[model samples]
Target chain A: QQPVQSPQAVILREGEDAVINCSSSKALYSVHWYRQKHGEAPVFLMILLKGGEQKGHEKISASFNEKKQQSSLYLTASQLSYSGTYFCGTLGGSNYKLTFGKGTLLTVNP
Target chain B: DAGITQSPRHKVTETGTPVTLRCHQTENHRYMYWYRQDPGHGLRLIHYSYGVKDTDKGEVSDGYSVSRSKTEDFLLTLESATSSQTSVYFCAITGDRGNTEAFFGQGTRLTVV
Candidate 1:
């Protein structure tokens, strides 16, 4: 099943902070975060594994709670470039398939 | 950026017609996925392929079919297109077993009239 993301949309002023949360009902092996700009492809941000290990782009960071089957993306000192739709993808037990959440639209105004 | 290319970046087809979108990757990633992005639905997986000739249906597989004849090519076909099927299609690839990040193609905007 697809994961659920909270706050369908949010508006932020430059340098403000925002957090996007993703929750999954089933156990997850890994959680991935990606950002998509308008009319562009989704770009990888970071990934959190079951063991609390995180690997991803240096500019973005996230946290994964294996016990709770949840993940949160932290955006600090947001900039206009941070404006976009953020999606969280989850990977279950064995397959390479990744399912994504509905997405959170974040608009950063200058 | 990952050597992934999607053909016919934009297409407009009539209802009940057959349309095919092609995804070609030079990365030779073992896993290839087809997803459709709608306004509120986000990106919904339509189908996926693990290897050549090894494909499986995803959550929203109805009215769609897929084929992977070679390691570098994966194709998604709409047997009979409909207005409801109009959306942006993305083709993504991952080299490892869910450990590495997926590389996505630019995407194909398909419109059914």
Candidate 2:
């Protein structure tokens, strides 16, 4: 099954912070994150495989809670360039397919 | 920029006609996938291949077919396109398992009238 993302949409100003959460009912082996600009393909952000592993890319960071079957992405000091839709893809058990979350649209303005 | 490229970046076709989207990868990854993105549904997998001639259907595979006769190429075909099939299609490649991060192509926007 596909993972569920919270806060369908969010708005932020420059230097503001926001969090996007993804949750799945089944245990996850890994969670992958990506960002898509308008009219473009999604770009890979980061992947969290190990339990409790956190990765960062510039002002973006993400944490995975294996026990909770959930992951959270943090956007710190958001910038106008960060305005895009974020999606989380999850793989569980022996499933070879990566199920994607609904997605969260984030708009950052000056 | 995983050396992945999709052909026919944009296409408009008539309903009931057959269309094919091609994805080429230079990295020679073992796993290749085809996914379609819609307004609120995000991206949904259509089909994938673990190796040459080995393929499996995904959640939204109806009306869609995929072929991977070689490791470096994966093709998605719409046999009798419909208006509902109009969307952006992405091709991705992964390493050993599905848990690994996938590299995506720019995508092809297909419009069926």
Candidate 3:
């Protein structure tokens, strides 16, 4: 099943912080975070394993909760470069394909 | 970043015509995938191949077929193009499942008229 993303869209000023949440209905093995700028392909951010470990890249971080079948991405001290659509790819229930959430549109203004 | 390249970066076709998109990777990754990105749906996997001649259907594989005859190439074909299939198609690769990060190609903008 496709994962669910909260706060379909969010606007933040530079230096502000924002959080994007993703949830799945099935037992998840991992959660992958990716950022896609307009007119470009999605770029890998970080991946959270099943043990609920937290991972970070620069000011971006994410946590995966296998038991709860959910994950959350936190972007702190946002910058204009952070403006993009964030997607969470999920692997769950012994599924071969990684499913993605609808995505959260983030706009960071100067 | 994985040296993955997709062919026919942009295309336009009439409805009911056949369309094929090619994905070539120089990384020799163990996995390759075809995904379609549409507004509000993010990217949905259409098909994936684990090894040469070994393929699997994804969440949204209807009307699409895939083949991986060579390790460096994976192809996605639409038997009959439809307007709903018009979207930016991306090819992704990963050395391992869930253990490694996946890299995507520039993408192919496909339009069905």
Number of the top-ranking candidate, with TM-score as the measure: 1
Stretches of candidate 3 off by over 4 Å are A53-56
Task: Give the alpha carbon lDDT tens digit for every residue of B16-109 in model 3.
Answer: 9999999999998988999999987889888999899999999899999999999999999999999999999999998877767889999999
Q: What interface Cα RMSD is found for model 1?
A: 0.8
Restricted to chain B, the TM-score per model reads: 0.99, 0.97, 0.97
Order the candidate numbers by TM-score, best to worst.
Answer: 1, 3, 2
- How good is the docking of model 1, as DockQ? 0.81
How close is every model to the real structure, measured as TM-score?
A: 0.97, 0.95, 0.96
lDDT of 3 by residue, A1-110 (tens): 68999989999999999999999888888889999999999899998988756454766888777788888999999999999999999876475577788899999999
Q: Can you list each candidate's DockQ?
A: 0.81, 0.69, 0.80
**Which candidate would rank higher by lDDT, 1 or 2?**
1
Indicate the residue-level lDDT of B47 in model 1.
96
Give candidate 1 misplaced runs (Cα > 4 Å): none
How close to the true structure is residue B94 of candidate 2, measured as C-alpha lDDT?
87
Better of 1 and 3 by DockQ: 1
Per-residue accuracy of model 1 over A2-33 as CA lDDT, tens digit each: 89998899999999999999999988999999
